[model samples]
Target: MLQSSPKGSSSLSDNDNSSDLKSTMNDISSQTNENSDYSILPMDVIVDILSFLILSKQSINEYCNFLQSVHNKNHHSIFNLFFGYKHWDIHKTHVVFLYRNFIVKGDLTPYESRNPSEKVEQDGFIMNYIFKHAHTLTVDYCPMTDTYCQSLRKNKRIERFTFIGNRKHYHSGLCSALRECESLKKLKLDSVYDWEFTKLFELASLTYLKLNTGMMLRDFPPQKYNFDFIVDIEENQGSIKKILKNEFSESRLKHLSLISSEGFTDEYSVSNLMKLPALEILFLENQKITKQSMRTVGQSNLREICFERCLNFSDSGMEQLMKVKLPNLTKLKLSGCGFNTSNLKKVFEPSNGEILNQLTYIELSKNQNMKDTAFSKLGSFKFENLDTVDLNHCVSLSSIGILTFMRSFSECIRTLKLRECNLDETALVTILKSCSKLQRLDLEMNNISCTNIEICEITDLSNLHYLRIEKNNLTDIEWLIALPLSNLQLPRKISNYGTMQLDRQIP
Candidate 1:
C-alpha cells in the first residue's frame, strides 16, 4: 500500500481514462434527447400524412403486404379491400404467395385424425382473423388447409359459401364448416360424395345451392372422373322430401340451383321436389332428369326455370312444364335445349285457357327441330304481356312460322330476335305488315330476298327503334328511311347512292 513506483503510476492513469469515457457517454445521451425533440411533430399532421399514404393504390398494396406478415386478421381485411374493386392487378405476381399465406394465417390444415380438440386453439385463432367481414368465402381444393374453416364458426354475416374438395381427400370438414355458417343463404359444393344433404336444413337462411361432379369411387377412376354418384332411390326420395318439408316449414329459401349429383333414378326424388313451397327460381343444367320428373319439380313453388343441355328433356317435358302454374313466373330460357316443334308449339299454346298470362319473356334459341307448325301453334295464344322473344338458330323454321308468330303477339312484343331463321320474301312482307309495334328486330343471316321492289316495301317499319338486317343478299335498302330508329345494325356492302341514305350503320 505504501509502494509509490512506476506500476502504481500506470494504475492511476487507467482510472483517469475510465472517468473520461463515462463523461463522454453522458454528453452523447444529452445530444440524443435534443435530436428526439426536434423530430417530434403534431399528431394531427402525422395522421394527415398517413391518410394520404394509405389511400394511395401503391400504399394500400404495400400496407397489405406488410399487414400479411404481421397479422392474419389484418391481411384478410386488406385482401378483401383490394378485391372489392372491379379491377386490381396488385396480387397478380404474388397470387401463389398470397394463397400460401392465407393457409398459414388460417392454419387450416387437414386433420391427422378426426377430432375437434386436435387443433382447436389454432382453428380458433385462424377463425378470429378470417371471420371479421368476409360474407362470402371459398375453401377450394387446398388439401392441407383446414385452419381457416373454424374461423367461420358462429359467424353471423357470411351469406354465401363454396367448398370444392380434392379428388382424393375427404370432405367431412366441409360438412362441418356448413353447420357453422348459420347465416349462409347460397351454397355450392363441388366434388363431394355422400353428403348428408339433410344437414343443410340447419342453415335456415339457405336459398340457393349447386351440387356438381361428386364421386364415391375409392380411387380416381379415370372414366368416372367427371361423374357424380347416385343415392338409392328410396334414400333420394326421402332426402328430397326432407329438403322440401324442412325448407318451407323452417326457412325462407326462394332460389335453388341443382346441378345433378348423378342421373336421378328415383321417381320419389322427382315427386318430393314439388313440395318446396318457397322455391321460386330453379336452374337445372347437365342433368338427366326427364320431363316426367320435371312436372313434379315444377309443381313446387318455382316460378322460373332455366334449362340448358339437359338432353332427356324433350317436347314431353315442355308440355308438363307449361302445365305447372307459375303465377309469379316471368322468364323462361330453353337455350341449347333439345326442344322440337312440339315443345315450341306449346310455348304459344294457352296454358289452362290463358297463355301463361303472366309470362313476359321466352327464349328458345338453338332448337333446330322447330318449324312452321311451331309458329302456327304460337298464333293460337295471346301473349298479352309478352315483351321479348328470341328464336336464334332455329334453322328449320321458315317464314310461314315467323310471319304468324310475329302477327299473333305483335301488340305486346317489342323485341324479337330471329337470327339465322330460314326466311324468304313472303315471310319478310308478312312480318313488316304484322309487327307494327315492333321496336327491335334481328334478321341476321336469314334468306330474305333483297330486291329493289321488296326493299321499297320495307318502309312500313315506322316504330322500329333497333333493326339488324345483316348477312342477307341485299344490294339495296333504300326503304329504311321511314323510321326514327336510333340504332341500325347491317353488314358492310357496296350500296349505290340510289339505294338508301346512310344515316348510321352498326355491324
Candidate 2:
C-alpha cells in the first residue's frame, strides 16, 4: 500500500513538482518489502510511467483548474466580452495546461468585430501552445472569415476537422488554410459546392469524409413545372465524377457520407468511390435512387451501407441488390425506403436455406407496405448472431408478422423496435412473453386497445430494462408492475393510464 504525500503549494515550479513526485516514489519504495512484487519495479519503468502521465495531456484538477482563475468559464466569458474568445491571459502570469479540442461557434459573436489572429498569437496563447496540443477542431456555424482563416493557419496538430457553415463562405484564404492542413485525416463539411470540392484535393491523409446538404446543387434551378425541386442529375454527373476521382486519387478515404438524389446516377459517381482502395462504410441518405444506382452499390466492397428515405429503391430494387451476395456487408439499414414483405423475404431466408447469415444488424423501418408475408418465409436460421432488429413504423404489419418475427428471434434479439406499427393486445402479450432477453423494447404509438390487461404469470421479461410504450393505450398496469423492473424506463403517456412515474433514468 502507498502513503499519501504532503500537499505542495500551487506555486511550485517544474523542479519542485519533479522533486515531490520522486519523494512520493521513494516513500512507496521504503514501505514495500523485498518479497513484494512492486519492490522489484525498475526505476526506469517508474520514470517512464510518470513521463507518460505528464505527456498524455490529461487534465487533472490541478492541471485543469489548479491555482489560477484562468480555468474559470466566467473569467473567459468576461475576457471574451472585452476582447475576444481566447485562452490563457499570459500578462496575468497564468500557467495553462494542454487542451484536446478547440471549437468556435460563430452564432454568438459577430463575425466582423474579432481579430482571431491577435487573440491566438498575442494576447492569449504563448508560442501557440493551445493549438499545438489540440487534436480535434470544430468550427460550427462559422463562415470563412479572415479572422478564423488566420487562426486556423497555425493549426498544425489538428487531425479531425469539422466545419458547418452555409454556402456563402467564399474566402480564398480560408479555403487554402483548410486544404493545407498536413495533419488532417477526417473532415465533415456542410453545403459543399463545385468550387469548394476542389479545396479538399490537397489533404493527403483524409480518410473519413461526410459532406451534407446536397453536394451538387445546380446554379440555375429550373422553374416549377412537374416538380418545384432543383434537378442536377443530367447536368452534374460528369462534373461530380471528375471531381471525386481527382480528389481521392492519392487519398485513402474509408468512410464516406454523400447525398444521393442526383449525386448518384448510373454508375458514374458512386462507382468512382468504389475505386478507392480503402473505402468501406457509405451513407446515402434521402434521395430517389434508380436501378442503375443500386447496381453500382451491389457490386461495391462496402462493409456497411445505409439507404435511408430513398423512396425509389422499391421491392424489386432491394431484391436485385440482395441476390448479389455482398460477403463484406455486416450492417444493412434500408429504413424509410420502399422495400416490403415480398422483396425483403430474401433478407430473412437465403445463403443455403439460412437468412443473410452474415448481417449483424438489419433495420427495415418505415416500410408501410410490409405485411404478414414479409415474415412468412423466415426460417430457424442461425439468428444468434443478429443482435438488433428495427421494424418501426411498419403500420401495415399485423399481429401475424410481428408474432412470426418475435417467435423466430426472441432468444437472440437484444434490441427490438416496433413503434407506430399499430400493434394490438395479442401482439403486446406475445412481445412480453417471447422477447424475454430484450434489453431495449420500443412499442411506442402501438395503441394496444386493452383497458384491462392480464399480466401473464409465466412471461419472462427479466432482462428488459428500457421500455418505450409512449402514445399507447394499454391501460392495464398489473403486467408492468409484476416484472423485475429495477430501472425500467416508462413513457410519460403510459403514466396517464395510472399512478406511474415517468422519470426513472432518461433512457
Candidate 3:
C-alpha cells in the first residue's frame, strides 16, 4: 500500500494531470491496508476505470501492476513489458501497426483465402479480437477482398465509424456494414457516394453525422477551380443546397455546421436548411448570403445562429431580422460579416418599431465599415436579458454611439470586448461612467492614451476579473496601481506619444 502526498505531485513532471489519479489511488490503498483481510475491487471495475486512462497513458494497468509485483520482490520479464516509450512515436506505431480497428494493410499474403497451407490463425484472431470489442472503428482504403465487410459488420455496439476511401470502395463497404450496425449513432465519410441513403435511415439511434465533401475541389464543367482563392459565392451556394436538400432532413439533428474554405451561403440554401424541425444551432460561413437569408432563420426554432465572413448581410438584413418572431433565439454572431457606419442605423433602428428581447449575446467584429451611429443604435436596442456584447476592431467608432449603447445595458451585461476600436480617453471614461455591472472588459489595441487614469475610474465594476488592454499608446504605469481586479492584461508595448485628450465629459 502506498500513500500519496496531500498536495499530489507526480515524479513525471510532464504528466501533471495524472497527479489527481495517483492521489486518489493512494488514498484508496491507505484505507484498504494489505495486512487486513479485505476484498479487492472487481476486475470489471478496474477495466472500466482503466479504459478512460487508456487513451492518454499507454498500458497504465501494466505499470501499476508491475510496481505491485516488484514490491514483493518477484520481478520478471513480464515487468519489462510495462516500460512505456517516453515519446508518442512508439505509441502511434503500435496503434498503426498492431491495432486491427484502424484497418492498416500489413502482410496480407498469409491472410489470403487460397492459402490453405499458410498460417492465417494470428490474423483471424487479431481481426476477431478488434471487431468484437471496438466502439470506435476507422477503415481507410484497407483491401478486404477475401473477407467481405459482413464479417466485421456484426459489431452492433460500435458507436462511431470513419470511412476514407475512393467513391466505389467506400460506398459499397458502408452499404454492407450499415445492415448490421444497429448501435452506430455517428458516421463520418470524407468521400462522396451515390445516394444510398436507405442504409443511413435504418439506424434508429443515429443522432449525429458529419460528412465532408471537400475532396473534389472543383466547380461544374464550365468553371475551373480557382487558385489562391477565397470561397466562390456561386460554388458555395450549390454545395450548401446539396446538403440541405439531401442530408439535413434528420429530425434529431440539433447542431449543424458547414465550414468551407470561405464563409457564406446564399438565400435559397439557407431557407431550405431552416426547415429542420430539431435543428437548434446552425453555422454558415464564407457564402455571399444577403439579409434576406438571415430573415429566413427567424421562421425556424433555432436558438443560436453564426454567420462568418458573409459580406452581403448589410443593414437591410438587420431591418428584416427585427420583424421575425424568434422567441427561442438566444445567441447571434456576425463575425467578418462586414457592416459600415451608414448601415448601423438600419441594423439598430427599432425593427418594425419594436425591440428584440430574445437575443442574449451579440458579437459584431472585423467590420471596417462601422461608425459612431452603429454603436449608438446598439446602445439603444433595449435588450433586457443581454449579457455579452463584442464590438472589436471598428476603428472608426466614436464615443457617442458606445456610451449610448452602454446606457441601455448598464446593469445586465457581464462581458464586453471592444478591441482595436477607435476609443480614446473620452470613450473609455464614458463607458466606465455608464457600465457599472460588467464582469470582463477587453479594450485592447485601441487609440486610448490614458490607460491608468481610465482604469481608476472603472472601480464600480466589482465583479470584473478578466481585463485586457494590449498594444496601446497608454504608458502610465500607475493607472492600474489602485484598481482591485482578479485578472489584468497589460499592454505588450505601452507608448507615450499622445496627450490625454477628450472631446466630451460625463455631466
Clashes of each: 7, 0, 12
lDDT score of residue 27 within candidate 2 = 52
Q: How accurate is candidate 1 locally (lDDT)?
A: 0.55
TM-score of each: 0.63, 0.66, 0.61
For model 1 the local lDDT of residue 231 reads 21
Sorted by lDDT (best first), the order is: 2, 1, 3
Give the whole-model CA lDDT for all candidates, comma-separated: 0.55, 0.57, 0.54
Off by over 4 Å in 2: 1-100, 108-134, 150-154, 169-176, 198-202, 214-251, 260-267, 296-300, 351-355, 379-382, 451-457, 484-495, 498-507
* Cα lDDT tens digits for candidate 1, 411-449: 787788988998765666666666767777788788755
- Steric clash pairs (candidate 2): none
Segments in model 1 whose C-alpha atoms lie over 4 Å from true places: 1-128, 138-144, 162-172, 188-198, 214-248, 260-270, 294-299, 342-352, 378-380, 425-429, 452-463, 474-507
- Give the clashing pairs for model 1: 107-147, 108-145, 108-146, 108-147, 109-144, 109-146, 127-151
Worst 10 residues of 1 by lDDT: 91-100
User: How would you encode candidate 3's per-residue C-alpha lDDT over 303-384 as one tens digit per residue?
Assistant: 8888777777765665566666666788888887777766566666555233346668988877777777765555345667
In what order do the candidates fall by TM-score, top score first?
Answer: 2, 1, 3
TM-score of 2: 0.66
